[model samples]
Target: MIGRWIFIRGQAMGRRGWLALAALFIVALIVLMPLRMILGLTMPETITARSVEGSVWGGRIGDLNAGPLPLGTVDAGLEPLPLLIGRPQFAIARDGFSATIAPSRIIHANGSVQIPDGLGGLPVTSVGLGDFSAAMADGQCTEAQGTLSLTLAALGPLLPDAITVSGQARCEKGALVVPMRGPQGMERLTLKIGGDGRWQADLTLAGLPQETVEALKSSGFDTRPGGIGIGTSGTF
Candidate 1:
């Protein structure tokens, strides 16, 4: 009788051990699932990519684009700790720059991206962001902090040489605003981005020679008493 009791107890314990191991296996499988499987469900509509390959813990996104700007190929991964608390976060890195993205905000390190289509109607060559961050609520900007730089490409000899301007980024009336000025402070550019991905850019050149002003006017700029202004708007 004693022997039978001991045997029965041993069998039950072994079954319990196996059940625990099976449970752990299932959890591991779910945690390391491929990103391609869940990308459509987790990715934001404002961001798109040509291809996603690898597991959620670590993956590569090909030909990624933020609005209309290209981000090239980037390494990305999901933060598991955030998901446990119901707040999903994504970490992205490319060209030695990194950023963290949450549902309503994004934090960036120093980085620059080439503007293939320029900005609005201006022939912008590139954009550089330094410690830039922005938060949004209800389709509008709630907070914006950082510095921004833009390189305006020269339009041959008809226009001045390529010039870069630096300025602060801030929140203005719920829109994210960036005001950049060249070294001489004669060249200015303002950019605004809405939460819905719509954007507009305005460039003004002041104190230029009359000859140069006429050249700019011929290049589609509007002649104004203050200076020559060029404006364009589009959806990201």
Candidate 2:
């Protein structure tokens, strides 16, 4: 009879222990669920996020800023599976950019972004980006098309070869120019700041779009056969 009683006691103790553990799990979720708010207070100074909404399990950030650069709005959510492997990852996205950032590196980050160097956020003068601000400000289409795959470097900046462009030219001037040849006759194109922090192109467009040629006139290029040269330096 005593042996049977002990067996029953053991069963009760096991059940009680499980119940306690379940309770703790619930509490932990509650405490950590509002991780977005916590992030605002603790995130690195270079990153500024506002109006954090969502639980620790997942969340959204409105108007996230990296120093003076505005990231607009971004959404980040925790992935459940990574937790099992002793590492946690958050899938983050903002506009044309998306990536999962972890302690070691940024995962599957793919997107394109322009960086500003001059007073008007234009590329530096040394890289020959004179036409960037004017073209962008007028909403003119450069017809540049391409994909952006980003991987975080051990240092803060993006690693070399992180930027890839496919268009009429790999680069021109101080910009990674992507002048897409399209059905509309390649009248437009796109340009982004290159990895060197200078906006210079490695290759100039062989076939210049009429609009691009006109737009770049001030920057010293024209629709002429070779599409004008970039080596010469002057104010247009």
TM agreement with the true structure for every prediction: 0.87, 0.41
* Model 2 ranges with Cα > 4 A deviation: 1-31, 37-46, 65-71, 93-99, 103-105, 109-146, 149-203, 209-217, 220-236
Q: Which ten residues in a row have the lowest lDDT in candidate 1?
A: 35-44
**Superposed model 1: Cα runs more than 4 Å off:** 1-19, 158-160
Query: Model 1, range 1-236, lDDT digits (tens) per residue?
Result: 99999889767777778788899999899778887666667657877889999987799989877777677888988888878888767788998467777666777646888888888777888878899888888988998888889998886585658989889889998899999999999888889998887889888889988888888788788886689988899997
For each candidate in turn, give its C-alpha RMSD to the true structure in angstroms.
4.2, 13.8
lDDT string, candidate 2, 50-93, tens digits: 67887866778787654334555778877778869866666778
Per-candidate clashes, comma-separated? 0, 17
lDDT against the true structure, each candidate: 0.83, 0.46
